[model samples]
Structure formats: structure tokens, C-alpha cells
Target: MARSARLAAQGLAIGLVVGLLTLLVWRVANGNGKGVAQALADGEHPTAPAFDLSRLDGRGRFDLASLRGKKPIVLDFWASWCVPCIHESRRLEAARKEYGNRVAFIGVDTKDFSGDAREWQKKHGITYPSVHDGSGSVLTKWGGLPIPRIFFVARSGKVVGELIVEEDLPRYLREIAAS
Candidate 1:
């Protein structure tokens, strides 16, 4: 009985390992492989992954590809529940006032409800446009999780950099604006 139980346990462990491996392979096959953050860390400036999602406002959908070559973009990923996102987004709003004409400030409301995101935007006084990323699939491409991941894409559509520090915000904004 003891020997049989040990064999069963081993089989279950092997099954779990195989399951995890299959999931990893599936994600890689579906374009959910290495993220933009990893590519940046490896000294690569990849093209910003495109997404078309519904606007938090009642307006029509927003397509990232639409502005790809035409304008430099500041992509801000945030959720209503994230406290830190409030501050970061507010700062972006202030920056937008100065750079709005030259640069596009787009927000991706990741893994959050549309109504709440809209409310949050209003409450925080964030005037720039935002699209809902309820499933977080778009967020996965730009580097998933930890909320408030802001990236700058040049006019050429190449992702320039992500905001790593408070100082990075203005620096990236300037770089992308000039691109």
C-alpha cells in the first residue's frame, strides 16, 4: 500500500509539471511570450504592440495602431483600485497640457471596470483619453502587473522606454515628443 501511494504521488507531481509546461508553451505560441519590459531590459526597443479597445468614455473604440506612425505616444497602464496610479496619472494629465498637441497621452485601464475607471478619471481630473483593458491581454504585451507601468513610444512606433523613476516621466516624454 505504501509503495502504491508513493507511485501515485509521483504521478501527480509529474502531471502538474507537465501541465505547467504546456501552459508556458501555449502562452509563447499565442504572442504572450517575453514582454516589452524584458525586451527593453535586453537593450531592445520593440514596436509597440497594437490594440483596439473601447474607450472608458462613451466614445467609440481607440486603436493604438491609428496613431502609430503619425504621433509619439505616452502609454499609461493603470487601474482604479491602484492608489499609486492616481498620482502617476495626474502627473501625466499635467504633462498633457504642455505636450498634448505634439504627443498623444493614452491610458490603458487594465483589469478594471469601465464605469469605475471613468469615475476615477473624473475624480482625479485626468483629461486625456483612456481605453478599457478589462482582460489585461493588452497589458500583458506592454509588461503585465504592478499597475502604473508607463511606456513611451516614438513617432516611428518603436517603444522607447518605460518609466522606472519619477524623473523618467519627463525625460521619456521629451524624448518621444522629439521623435
Candidate 2:
């Protein structure tokens, strides 16, 4: 009986490990094979993945493709529960003052309740329009998890870069704004 129990424990452990590995493989093999962040890191200027989602402000659905070639975009990925998002989002709000006419500042509220997200926007004084990404599917295409992943897209719909430092916000904004 003791030997049988040991064998069963080992089997279960192996099964768990296999399951986790399979999950990781599936995630990497799926539509997120090379996420925007990875592509940017590889020095590839990939076209922005399109997504149409309902705006949190009840302004109806916003199709990202609609803005292609017409304007540059500052895409901010955030969540209501993420504390750091507050600071980053507020910084964006401040930046909007100077670039509001030249660039579109859009937010993706990922993996959070729309109601809470709306309240967060109002509380934080974030006036930029945002879309609800409750399923995080759009976030996955860009970069998953670790909220506040900001990306800059040129007027041609090509992703320029992702924010890695505070200075990057202004630098990418200038680059994309000129595109």
C-alpha cells in the first residue's frame, strides 16, 4: 500500500507538470505566437492588431482599424485594480494637453469590470476615451498581464514602440506624432 501511494503521488506530480507545460505551449502557439511587445523588441515594426470593442463611456463600439492612416495613436493598456495604472494614466492625461490635436490617446481597460474602470477614470481625471477589454483578448495581442503597457502607433498603423521608461512616453509620442 505504501509503495502504491508513492507511485500515485509521483504520477500526479508528473501529470501536473505536463498539464502546465501543455498550457504554456498552447498559449505560445495560439494567436499570440509573437506578441506586439516581442516583435517590437526584435526591431520589427508590426502593424497594429485590430480590435473593435465597446467604449467604456457608452459612446458605442470603437474599431481600431477606423483610425488607420488618418491619425497616430497612443495606446494605453490599463486596469482599474492596478495601482500603477493610476500614475501612468494620469501622466497620459497630462501629456494629452500638448498632443491632443496631433495624436489619439486611447485606453484599453483590460481584465477589469467596466463599472469599476469607468469610476477609476472619473476619479483619476482621465478624460481620454477608453474601450473595455474584459476578456483581455486585445491585451493578449499587444502584451498580456502587468497592466499599463503603453504602445505608440504611427499614422500608417505600424506599432513604433512600447513604454519601458518614463522618458519613452514623450519620445515615442514625438516620433509617432510626426508619422
Candidate 3:
């Protein structure tokens, strides 16, 4: 009877350990996608990863570190095929037009053809430069997630904010400017 009880206790302990591990993995994988405004409202600061990608123009490569000396950089990871990305392109073009020198805006086209990205930019009048992430190398470094993601980096090269929605963009940009 004692041996059976000991086995049962061991099983319970193992089950509890497995449950805890599963919970931890779930939390890590299911990150708080609660757009930037909501995260800020709850007092959270989202960070962006270091970025270095080749330019679509083929003129030169762009490294996040290179922009450190200049104004804050805003990066949008998107694709022409993404419906929401289409809307985001329009919004970013406006921001680029209004705050041209105040900030450096860039777009990273993920898993998309260069021609498609170029066409999308031309159609929307996007003045900012866009880099290609066809191999998803930059995306993996930037926390491999879905498209239409925005990362706001400070002038010092540190990421200060991350937003996942086009609707929350205006407020997110305002907050970034304030910060």
C-alpha cells in the first residue's frame, strides 16, 4: 500500500511540473498583441529587435545602427499581398510626408516579391525606403511574427514601442513623438 501511494505521489508531482511548463510556453508564445495604445494604457513598454536589411532600391543596405545618429526610425514590416498592409502603407506615407526630417520611416517587405512591393509603393506614393525580407532573416531577428507590425526606435537605437494595428497608428505615432 505504501509503495502504491508513493507512485501516485510521484505521478502527481510530474503532472504538476508538466502543467507549469506548458503554461510558461503558452504565455511566451502568445505574446500580448494588445496594440501599442492598449499596452501603454496598461503601462507596458514593447521593444523592437535590431534590424539590418537590404534596400529594395539596390542602392545600399540599411542597418538600424546606421540610423542611430539621425532621428528616431520607424520600421513597418509588411507585404503587398496583406490587405491591412495596404492601409498601413497609406498611413505611413502620410507620416513620412508630414514628419520627413523629424523621423526616418522604413518598410520591410516580408515574403513578397520586389516588383510587387515597388508597385504598391508607387501606387500609394510611399516616399520612404523599403527593404526586402524575402528570406525572413530580418523577420526572425525581429521576433518572427505576422506582417503589418510596426517598430519604433529611439534616436539612440533602442526600440521604444511596437504596435500591431493600423487603427492605433495615429495614436502610436503621437506617443512615439511624445516619448
Please report, in order, the local distance difference test score of every candidate based on alpha carbons.
Answer: 0.93, 0.95, 0.74
Q: List model 1 lDDT by residue over 1-179, tens digit each.
A: 99999999999999999999999888789766688988998999999998999988869999999997899999999999999999999999999989999999999999999899999998999989999999999999888998899999999999999999999988998899999
Predicted structure 3: lDDT: 0.74
Better of 1 and 3 by lDDT: 1
Off by over 4 Å in 2: 1-31
Which residue pairs show collisions in model 3?
none
If candidate 1 were superposed on the true structure by all CA atoms, what would the RMSD be? 5.5
Scored against the true structure, residue 160 in model 1 reaches a CA lDDT of: 97
* Better-scoring candidate (lDDT), 1 or 2: 2
Candidate 1 lDDT: 0.93
